[model samples]
Target chain A: MTDPAVEAAIARVHREEWARVVAALTRRFGDLDIAEEAAAEAFAVAVERWPRDGLPPNPGGWLSTTATRRAIDRIRRESQRMAKHQAALMLHDSTRPDPSGPVEDDRLRLVFTCCHPALSMEARVALTLRLIGGLTVAEIARAFLVQETTMAQRITRAKTKIRAAHIPYRVPSGQDIHERLAGVLAVVYLIFNEGYLASQGKDLLRVDLTEEAIRLGRLLLVLVPEDGEVAGLLALMLLTDARRSARVSATGELVTLQEQDRGAWDRGLIVEGQELVRERVRAVAAGAGPPGRYQLLAAINAVHTVAPSSSDTDWSQVLTLYDRLAALDPSPIVRLNRAVAVAELDGPAVALAQVDRLADGLDAYHALHATRADLLRRLGRSAESRTAYDRAIALAANPAERAYLTRRRDQLRG
Target chain B: MARYLLSVFGPTDPPASGGSSSRSELLQEWADTGAFNDKLQREGHFVFADGLEPASTATTVDGRGERPVFTDGPYLETKEHLGGFWVIEAADLDEALALAAEGSRACRGAVEVRPFNTPESIQALLDS
Candidate 1:
C-alpha cells in the first residue's frame, strides 16, 4: 500500500512539476516522446520509492535525474539493438548537461513547440493540453469529446511531425516571437472558450477546462511577464469567468447579462482582473507598447466589472472599446458584438442599422440573430423580434441558449 | 547532423532587353556565386553543387504500366523549372534555412531547403 503522505506528495509533484520535469528532460534528450515517457516512469518510480525512502527535499531535481537516467538506459538499449549511431550520440549528449544552459525558460520553449504553426490548430490544442497542461491523453480526449485512440494518434502524429520536420524546440526570437505568441494566446483562449461556453454538451460550462486555461494563462504570465498581452489575456479570462455562477438560472436556463444577479459575481476574481488591467493600461500609457487586442478586451471587461449594475454600465466607454476592437479585427463576430454596445449607447435604430449591415456576413452566427432579436424587442417590434428569435433558436447549439431563445419568442407571441 | 537538399528554381527565359545587365554586373554575379560555393566548401558543408540544363532538354519516363514509357519534356508544365541544386550538411533546420538564404542571394533565384530522410530518422519517428 502506498503511504498517504507519499501519495499527497506525488499528487503535488504531478500538479506543479510535471511540465518542468518534462521540459528539462526534453531539452536534455532533444526528444519530446522520450522526455514525457521518462517523466512518467520517474513519477511511477516515485510513487513506489518515495513511500519507503522519504520525500526528497528537491523533488523536481530528483525526478529530473531519475527520468534522465531512464532515458539514457532506453537510448542505449535501442542503439545497441538497432546499431543506430545517432541514438548512441543522443545518449551520450543526454548524459552531460550543456555548459551553457538554455537562455530562455524551457517551459516557454515547450509551449512554443506545442503550439507551433506547422501543426493543425486542433493538434496544437491537444499537444498543449497534453504537454504543458500535463493532461492525460484520455482526459484531453474526453474534454474534446473524441475517442481516446483518436487523441493519442493525434498527439503521436504531431510529435512525429515535430521530429521529422526538425521544428526547433526554442522560443522564437525577434519579430517571430510576437507572431508565435499570438498562436500560444489563441490556444489558451480557445481552451477557455471551450470551458466558458461549451460547443456541445448538456451542461453550459466546463469548469475544469476553464480552470485549466486560467492556470495556463497564469503560467504564461510568469514565463513572459514583460508581455502586456499575456497579463491582459489572464485578466480577460478572470473577469469573464467571474460571472460563472451568475451566468445560468437555478434550472440551468441561460441568464443574459442584464438578468444575472451582480451580487453573485466572484468579487475576488473581479478585483484581481481589474488590477491586472489597470497595471497593463498604466504601463502602456508610460510608453510601453500599445495594448494589443486581448489587452483591449480585458479593459472592456474591466469596464463591465466596475459597474454596480447592468443598467449602470458605462455604455459609451464600452462602445468606444468595441469600435477599437472592430478596427483591430473587423470580423463579423466583432461587429455583431459591437452592435449590442451600440444599442445600449445609441438607441435601437442605430444599433439595428449596424446589425442589419452585418446580416449577410453573420447569417450563420446564432449570436447575430439573438442580438437582433433583443434589439427588435427593445424597439417593440414583437413580430420581427419573434422571427429573429426563431432563427437564433435554430442556430444555437447549446440547450440553455435554445431554451432561453424559445422563452423569449413565446413571450413575444403572447 | 542532417543533410538538406537546397533546390534552386528559376525562369527558363533569360533577362529581357529592358533589364539588360552590364559586363560588370555579370562579373559581380559570378563573383558572388563563387564566394557562396567557396564558403560552403570551406565550412565542410558542401557535398555536391551543380547547375542544370534548361527543362526543354529534359526527358520524362513513366513505368507504372507493364512496359516503360517516355515523354518529350519535363513532367510538369510550369513557368519556372529546377535550375540547380546543392546537397549540404547542417546541424538542424535553422542552419539549413540560413544556408539556403545565402544560396538564394548567390543564385538570385528561389531556394527551397528539404531535409533528406535517412533510416535513422524514419526509425526515430516509429520509436516516437
Candidate 2:
C-alpha cells in the first residue's frame, strides 16, 4: 500500500519539480521525448520506493539524478557504437559536485523551448501547458476541446519537429529574445483568457486554468525579474483576475465592470498588481525604454483597480493610456476597447463614430457589436441598439455572455 | 548537420499565354532563379536541385497492399503541386528556414522545409 505522505510528496514533486527534472534530462540528452520519458520513469520509481523508505532529503535532486541515469542508460542501450562515448559524457556531467543545488533555472529553458517561434501557436500552447505546467495530454486536450488523440499527435509532431529542426534548448539572447518573448507572453495571456472568459462553457470562470496562468505569471516574474514587459504582463493578469469574483452576478449573469460589486474584488491581488505596475511604469519613466503594449495595458488595469467605483475611475487617465496603447498597437480590438473609454469621456455619439469605423474589420467580434449596442441604447436609438444586441447575442460563444446579451435585448424590447 | 528538403509549390493552372511582355516575365523569373542557385552553390548549401514536370504527367504506385497498385496522375488533388525541390544541409532548423526564405524569393513561389530523420533519432523516439 502507498503511504499517504508518499503520495502527497509525489503529487507535490510532480507539480513543483517536473519541469526542472525534465529540463535537466533534456539538457543532458538533447531530446525532449527522452527527457520526458526518463522523468516519467523516475516518478514511477519514486512511487515504488518512496513509500517503502521515507522520502528523500532532496526530492527534486533525487528525481533529477534518477531521471538522468535512466536517460543515459536508454541512450547507451540504443547505440552500441556510441555507448562508451555517450555514457562517459553523461557520467562526467551528472557527477559534477556543486555546493549550490539546482541553481540554474531549467524551467526557464523549457519555457523558451516550448514557446519557440518555430512551432505553431497551437503547438506552443499545448507544449507549454504539458511540459511547463505539468498537465497531462488528456488535460490539455480537454482544455482546448480537442480529441485526446489529436492533442497527442500535435505534441508528438511538435517534439519531433523540434528534434528534427534542432530548435535550441536555451533562453534566446539579443534581437531573437525580443521576438521570442512576445510568443512566450502571448501563450501565458492565452491561458489566462481561457480561464477568465472560457471560449465555450456554461461558467464564466475556470478557476483552475486562471490560477494556473497566474502561477505561471508568478514563475515568469521569478525567472525574469527585470523585464518590464514581463512585470507588465503579470500585473495585467493579476489586476484583471482580481475582479473575477465580482465579474459575475449571484444569479450567474455576466456583470459589466460598472455593475460589478467592488466589495467582491480581491484586494490583495489589486495591491500586488498595482505595486508591480507602478514599479514598471517608474522604470519606464527612468528611460529604461518606452512602455510596451502590455505595460500600458497593465497601467490601465491598475487605474481601474485603484478606483472606488466605475464612475470614480479617472476617464482622462484611462483615455491617455488607451491613446498610447492605440498608437503602439492599432489592432481592431485595441481600438474597440478605446472606444469604450471614449464613450465615457467624449460621449457615445463620438465613440459611436469611432466604433462604426471599426465595423468592417471587427464585424465578427462579439464585443464590437456589444459596444455598439450599449452606445446606441444611450443615444436612444432603440431599433439600432436592439439589432446590435441581436448580433452580439448571436456571435457570443460563452453561454453566460449569450444569456446576458439576450436579457439586455429583451429589456430593450420591453 | 541535418538535411532539409525545400519544396517549391506552383499553382495548378497552366501559365497564361500572352504577348512578349508575358514571355519576358517568364524569362526574368528563370534568370532570377539561376542567380539564386548560383548563390546557393557559392555558399555550399546546395546538395541537389531539380524541377519536376506538371503533376498531370505524374504516376503513383502504391505498395501497401499485397499487390502493388498503379494509379494515374498525382496521389492527391491539391491546388498547388510540387514544382521543384532543393536538398540542402544546415546546422539546424533556423538555418534551414533562413535558407528556405532565400529559396522562396528565388523560386517566387511558396516553399516548405522538412527535415530528414536519422535512424538513431527514430530509435530514440521509438524507445520512448
Candidate 3:
C-alpha cells in the first residue's frame, strides 16, 4: 500500500512543484489551463493513491507523465461538453518518453510567451516570475515591494492580455526574433537587478533572484548559441555573482569592491565568465557584430576580476570599455561609471570635469553626486564637494549607502 | 484523516479602490489563475478552495448545541481577521501541522489544521 505519509508528501510537492511541472507539461499539451489543471490532478492522485502505492522513484517525471495524461483526458472530456471544443488533444501516452524535438521547442516557446512584447514590461516580469521562476503572487509581490493584491492584479492582467491578444506561445522568426530577443534580454536584466539589490528586506542581496537570472541567461545562451550578447550577459552575471561571496561582511554589512577581501570571491565562476567573454570577444572580432552592452559590461567586470588586487586594476582598459559602452548606449549611468574610471586613470581634476558634464543628467542620482563630491574633495574643492555631498545625502536610499557617502564627506572636511 | 482551513485576512480598513485593468486583461488573469487552481484539482490533493465575500458581511454567533445566539460581529473578533482557507488530509497532527505551515507560506495567512471525526467516534458517542 502507498504510505499515507508519502501521499501527503507528494501532495505538498504538487503545490511547490506545480508551476514547473505545468510549464514542462504545457510544452507537451499546448494549453495553459489544461496543462496546469492536469498537473494539479496528478498531485491530487498522488494525495489519494501515492499513500497506498508509496513514493515513485522519479516524482517530478511521474507528475509530468500523469499531468500530461490528465491534460489529454481533460481535452477529450471538454470536447464532449462543448461542440466548439474542436481542437485535437495533443496526446502522448503516460508511459512513453516525450519526443526531444517538441520538448526543446516548447521551452523556447514558453520563454517567448513569458517575455512577449504584447505584454507590458511589468506584466512580462510578473508572468516570467510566475511561469519561469515559479514564484507565487505573494512572492512576486514581496520581490516588487508591493502588496499581494496589487501584484495579483498585475499578473492577472498580464495573463488576460496574452490570452485576448492570442499571443502564440512560440519563438518569433525573422525580424521579429530580434525584438523578442531584446525583450528576453530586458527580462533577464530586470531579474538580475532585483537579485543584486533587493528592494526590501534585511539582506542586501537576494541570491535566489541572482541564481534564477543566471539560469535564464544560460538557458537563453543554449537556445541561441550564436547570440554573442546572450553569452556576454551570462558571463557578466557570472562574474558579478562570483564576487557575491565577498560582497558582505561577517556582520552582514555591504562591502564595496575596493574594500572587499578578494580571496573570498568564487574563482570558478570568474574563470567560467572569463572563458565566455573570451569566446564572445573572439566572435565579435570575427565581424559578427559590435559588442553589445552586456559584452561591454562583462569586459569591464573581466578587468576587475582579472586583476589580483584592487590596485592591480587596469583603470585605463576599463575606461576604454566604458567609453565604448557610452558610445553604444549613451546613458547617464554609463557616463557616471566612466567618470569614476577616468578619475583613476587620468586624475581627480580630469575626472571632476567628466562628473560635472554628467551632473546635469544625474543631478538626483545619489551615487553620481557622491562621485562628484569625492573627486571635488580630492581636488581641494572642499566647499563645492560638501554641497555635492549634502545633495547625495538627501537622495540616498538606504542607511549603509548613506553612511558610506557621509563618511566620505566627513573625511573630505577633515 | 485530518483537514485544515487556512484563511487570508486583508486589512480591516479597505483599500481606496482604483480603476481595474481593461476587461480583457482582467479576464485573462482570472483564466490564468483559474487554470492554476485546475492544476491543483488535477493533483487530487485539492480538498476545497474558494475566495470569500468581503469580511464586512460576516456575522458572529456564540453558544453551542441548539440554535446559538447570533451577533453582528465575526465568530472571532480580532484586528487581523480570517479571509479564506484550504482543506488538506494528512495522517497525523505533525504532518497536518507541516502542511498548514506550507499553506501559510503560500497564502501568507494563518492555517488551522484539525482532524475529521471518524464514523467510529459518532458510534462511540451513541454508545455513551
Candidate 4:
C-alpha cells in the first residue's frame, strides 16, 4: 500500500478502535497501566506492519485481538502474583465470542471514572482525551500547548490515583449518577469551551478539541439517552461551533458577534442545534422536568442563530433566556452576558449601569472591561471608553482579542 | 480499599454560646456526633475517631538534635490544628469525601480527608 494511504487508514482505525480496544483491555486486565501500554503497543505494531500487509479485514477486531495478546505478553513478562491472575483472566476472556450490546457499558464506565471529581479538572481532561478520545500524549500536549512529557506524567499520575484510590469503575446509580453525570457533562463542556476560545494562545480555536468534545457529547447522548442535559450540551456545542468561521477574520483578528458575517456562519449546525432545542422544549411541554443549564444555553444560542442579522436578533427573548439562566446559575459572567442584551433593549446607559455594578465581582475579567468599553462608546463617552479598552487590552490574553480591542479603541475619538 | 484521615478543623478556642438554649444546642450537636460515630462503627468504616483539647493546651517537644528544644504550642506553630479526626477505610476518594461531608455536618466543623500511603499506592507512583 502507498504510504499516505496506509497512514490515513491507520489514523482512521486508531480513532475508531482506540477507545474500544482500551475499554476492553481495561475490563479484562483490570489494570489501566497494562491496558494503556498494551493498546499503544498494538497500535505501534499496526503502524509498522499495516503498510506492508495492507489494511485488515476488520480493523477494530484486529486491534482488539492484538491489544489482548500484547496485554498477556506484558503480564507474562512480570512475575507479580496480581499480573498472573489478570493474565489468566485475559487468556480466558480472549477466547470467548465477544457479546454485542446496544450500549458499550465499558466505555461508559471509563467515561465516569475519567471524569470523577476526585481527579483534578486538568487531569480529567487529559485522561478523557487519552483513554476515551484516543488522542496520543503528543497530540493532547500540542492541543493544550504543553510538553509531551508533562502530559504523559499527568496521565500516568491520574491513572495511578484511580487505581490507588479505587475510584469505582462503573456508571454511578441513583443520586450519585445525577451528581456525577453533571461532572461528566462538565468535563465535556469544559473541553468545548477551551477549544471554542483559546484562553491564552496565538490560535483563536483548536478544532481538534472542539471535534473531540462533540464526539464525546454524541457518545454520551447514545450511552445515556434519557439525560436531557447530554443532548443540551451537544446542542450548545454545535450552535457555538457553528459560528467558528465568522468568529475570526482572514487577517486573524477576533470578530465580535455583532460584527461577524452571518452568511459565513454554518447554517447546518444552526439548524441541527435549533432542532434539538425545539425537541427539548416539546419534551418539557409534555411534562418532562424543567430545561437544564445547557438546554437553556442552547435555547439562547438558537434565538441568536435563528436571526437573519444582528439587528434582527430578538433582544427581549435573549433577555428572557438570560433571566431564566440567572435563576439557575447566579454567576457574574451570566449577568454580564445578560447586560449585553439589556443594552440592545433598554439602551447603552442602562446596560452601562448594570456593568458597573458587576465590577467588584468581575473587575479582573477582560470581557467585562471589553463590554464596558463598548457600552461607553455607544453612549458617546470616548474617554471612558478608551480607558476601559486600555484595561481590556492589557488584561486580555489572546492576541487576536487584543488586536480587535486595539482596533476598536483606535477607532474611538482620539 | 484505603484508609483516609478525616481531620476536623474547629475553632482553636471555642467561644461559649451566649444563651442557655445555645448551650443545649451544643449538647445536641455532641449527641448527634456520637450517633454518627456509632453509625460509622456499625458500617465497619470506623478505625479511630476522637476530639483533642484546645490548641492552648498543646505542648510540643523537639529532640531532633542532642540538645532538645521545647515549644509551647503545636509542633510547627500553625493555626490549622485538628479539632478531631477519624481514620476510616473507604473504597476510594469519593467514598472518603462523602463520609467526610457527613462527619463535618455531625461535628459542625470543616473536615479534610487525606489518603494514607499504602505499599500498592507507593509502588504505583514509582512505576508511573
Instruction: Give the best candidate by DockQ.
Output: 4
Model 1: lDDT of residue A72:
79
lDDT of 3 by residue, A216-295 (tens): 78767877877788998999999999999788767655677888899999999999999999998888888888988899
Of 2 and 3, the candidate ahead on TM-score is 2
Per-residue lDDT tens digits for candidate 1, residues A81-165, read 3466455447646655466974567899899999987689999999898889888999999888889999999999899877766
- Candidate 4 DockQ score? 0.48
Residue range B12-108, candidate 1, lDDT tens digits: 7545335346556656766887899999999999999998888888999999999989998899899999988999998766667778999899878
Q: What is the TM-score of each candidate against the true structure?
A: 0.82, 0.88, 0.67, 0.91
Which parts of model 1 have CA positions greater than 4 angstroms off?
A1-9, A48-54, A81-103, B1-66, B69-114, B123-128
Displacement of residue A92 (Cα, Å) in model 3 is: 13
Candidate 2's C-alpha runs over 4 A off are: A1-12, A45-54, A73-104, B13-39, B52-76, B121-128
Ranking according to TM-score, highest score first: 4, 2, 1, 3
lDDT of 2 by residue, B1-128 (tens): 78889999998765875888988888887888888888889988889998888888889999999999998889889988999999988877777887888888876888999887776567556756
Q: Taking the true A–B contacts (Cα pairs closer than 8 Å), what share appears in each candidate?
A: 0.47, 0.53, 0.00, 0.58
What is the Cα-based lDDT of residue A146 in candidate 3? 85
CA lDDT, every prediction? 0.88, 0.86, 0.73, 0.88
- Count of clashing residue pairs in every prediction: 0, 0, 25, 0
Q: Report the lDDT tens digits of candidate 3 across residue range B1-128.
A: 34444455665544444546555554564465456456556755468877666566788777785878878866666676666666655443434454556555555455554445544334434644
Model 4 iRMS: 3.2
Candidate 4 residues lying further than 4 Å off, grouped into runs, are A81-104, B11-22, B55-73, B117-119, B122-128
What is the Cα root-mean-square deviation between model 4 and the actual structure?
A: 3.2
Candidate order by decreasing DockQ: 4, 2, 1, 3
